[model samples]
Target: PIPGWTLERLHKGYGQALQETEVFYDSQTDHQRLRVFDNPRFGRVMTLDGVVQVTEADNFIYHEMLTHVPILAHGAARRVLIVGGGDGGMAREALRHASAEEVTMVEIDAGVVEFCKTYLPGISQGAFDDPRLNLVIDDGAAFMRNTQKKYDVIVIDSTDPVGPGEVLFTDSFYGHAKRALTEGGILVTQNGVPFVQGEELTNSMRAFKALFADWGCYLATVPTYAGGPMAFGWGTDGPGRAVTLAELEARAAAAGLSTEYYTPEVHKAAFALPGYVRRLM
Candidate 1:
């Protein structure tokens, strides 16, 4: 209603007011629209294609669940692959494991990486500067299809399945991801919130069921992602990948990892889906 004020709303097939900011940076990259704006309560926020990807206030919840669950469960994943996390927050958590020898992050957009590194340094904390990280600018699907390297963990940190991100949610992409991992390796993906985006979880779970021996979905709540708790798709052929609380506690101590939102107890609890979500999968 003001003459000079501008509003930015997140359009998740439905519009919701996210923030209104006067001081912000916006970019039109070759891949998508990237905006970083300051929010009074959430601190700095990043949105891609009108969807909130991360906020300085709650990024740890998303990045931690995305990284730790697979890495910690695998017990000794030295080689890791990250698909589409251009902001580098996932890589930062993966690198915390001293066992991680190499982490290859394949992001389609170099601009997203450059911009996030410059503006969201607090989130990634210079993860791009780490020697163990191999940053590749390429399509995630193409990289998965072409690479001969096998990783102990492969994480799909993609945006929603639209535009350039659509290819990543295909069955073909999941097949390639399964092939790119070593035996006992695990693959995890961002599957959106089942409360608002149930079809996304169903589609991903269907693909995983056909490809992996043991596949399931887990949960984490990121306030910025709204609607409900966010789901992460889990697929693996590894025996005993779903560890008990005692097993997780032992590994957590061994890894000596410190986290804000993820604990061994929480990790075990995340897989306990609600009744409706259980039916969805």
Candidate 2:
């Protein structure tokens, strides 16, 4: 009574994400995986053109932490830009700042944006419908080089450094990103897994250091991401001082911002690293 699953365990274990979804398994290597969600529940999940981008329904955890942390850290943000999040989840979070004057969402895929707007509305939640947003369906790299306007915060919601999104992980991109920010402006991006992409992590951090005088990589635990953990690198022209739990709480309260995951306690603790991770630098 199963569809194309000759192996019952594959169907049973990954069954939740594969429901009403197509699972494309790799024949050659242990790395290839993709699941396309066709039904109208959480949203459609599309992997990379080569590798699987999202394998589970719970990928939102990684998305959420990546987009919001840098914004909140800036205290009061007035303008924002999100490069390559066609799904609109990052846009939704970026708009949470009441002080945010305008948000420009530049996504490369019209198909992904349309699909997410139609089916994956839960994660994005009608963000495309917001008046504060200006949607541009185009390549993020080209947009970065061309735009003269600066922003208070920029969130790079790109996939891994694969294929079309590869240029996003380069020093050239970081150079443009530094120019795109205003004085004391900050930029944050999905830095990939600490376990699998450690050298990548170091290079990213070093790149940020070259671009901005004050820059660092911070982490959060998102189970569905990579190995139940994920990291995001932040680039800033300002100082990187430690902000305490109570201090963040007071600021959020004073600013009257509503938050579910990022609190002062969580924010302070998210930067905590183990011994091996400590040795990564």
Candidate 3:
């Protein structure tokens, strides 16, 4: 607390005390029109895809794991639906499976999609240019209700239950998602970190369980997100739906996806819950 020392210098020195970070790049997406920022340590950083999404440092691991695991578990998946993945990164992974014939992406915000396509090319890469991807700028719930066709897998890659995505976590939405899937189809949604928000996780799981025959709440580590640990809920209408790492790895090998974070060894490990977490269910 010196007279001449500015607050900016104090903050900068405090940050340097723990770690000095810099924003290498940032821009506004032309699609859904959200801001995208990237730093050196946290790769492919913040993306406000309609609701200040992905502020954490390590977004890739969480994004990749959430979209891929269920698709792999379904095994014979061909057509897929990704709700709220405006960055198109999920579409990139969805099409990685040779069995995946088509991927329909439904994003509520067109501005976010456009901005990512133009600015955050590192995450989406050349995904938008791919012929297999059909990008729709619309409400995912409405899209699910209107489509007559069914999909092998449905992934809910949305932000927290607030603003544009509040409806996504509702019971009715889960019921709608159930109808959008084929018989024995698998559904996965991004829940928040259970450790930080235990009640939210429990409530969301209870809602999904009411609509499905079986459910699994698993954990993943993403340094960029809040709490550094995140959770995902896999809801299915059949018992014994959990896929072991051995199974997922064999499938990944056949498909030939050189993934950075997801591996068969990590798959089983991810689902292994701690004692307190087991108590919550």
Judging by TM-score against the true structure, name the best candidate: 1
Give the alpha carbon lDDT tens digit for every residue of 144-263 in model 3: 778888888999998776557778888888888989988888888888667665665787788887888888677887654445367888888843256766778788898897887888
Model 3 TM-score is 0.84
TM-score, predicted candidate 1 vs. hidden true structure? 0.95
Q: 1-281, model 1: which lDDT tens digit per residue?
A: 34433343433475445545644678799999998888777888888987888888999999999889998898889999999999999999999998999999999999999999988898888789999999999999999999999999999999988778999999999999999989999999999888888988899999999999999999998988877899999999996356888988888888899899999999989988999898888
Model 2 pairs in collision: 47-53
TM-score of each: 0.95, 0.82, 0.84
Candidate 2, residue 59: lDDT: 54
CA RMSD, predictions in order: 1.8, 5.6, 5.3
lDDT score, candidate 3, position 175: 83
On TM-score, the stronger of 1 and 3 is 1
Candidate topping lDDT: 1
Candidate 3, lDDT over the whole model: 0.71
